[model samples]
Target: QVYVNGELIGGCDITLEMFERGELQPLVEAAVKVQEGNQQA
Candidate 1:
């Protein structure tokens, strides 16, 4: 499973498919944005 900030985002089966379709990049980018926002806050 994939976890972001200790929250489950998806499972390996779906995540792998997303990775193949290049869909996971956006999720990772959003996670980074959220982390940066939290740090700034």
Candidate 2:
């Protein structure tokens, strides 16, 4: 799932293991992009 400031942005299904692995940099980057978009608007 994607989120911005507690709002849901996008959603997907994934394994709990993958989520627990802490592989969140890409997701964080995406969230940053969303935040930037919101800021620009």
Question: Which regions of candidate 1 deviate over 4 angstroms?
Answer: 5-7
* Candidate 1 Cα deviation (angstroms), residue 26: 0.9
TM-score, model 1 to reference: 0.73
Query: Highest lDDT: which candidate?
Result: 1
Give each model's whole-structure lDDT: 0.86, 0.62
What range of 10 consecutive residues in model 2 has the weakest lDDT sum?
Answer: 9-18
Top TM-score prediction, candidate number: 1
- Model 1: lDDT equals 0.86
TM-score of each: 0.73, 0.47
Residue-wise C-alpha lDDT for candidate 1, range 8-41, written one tens digit per residue: 7689998898889998888888889999999999
Q: Model 2, which residues run further than 4 Å from truth? A: 1-22
Candidate 2 lDDT by residue in tens digits, 1-41: 76555755455544344356665556667788988999999
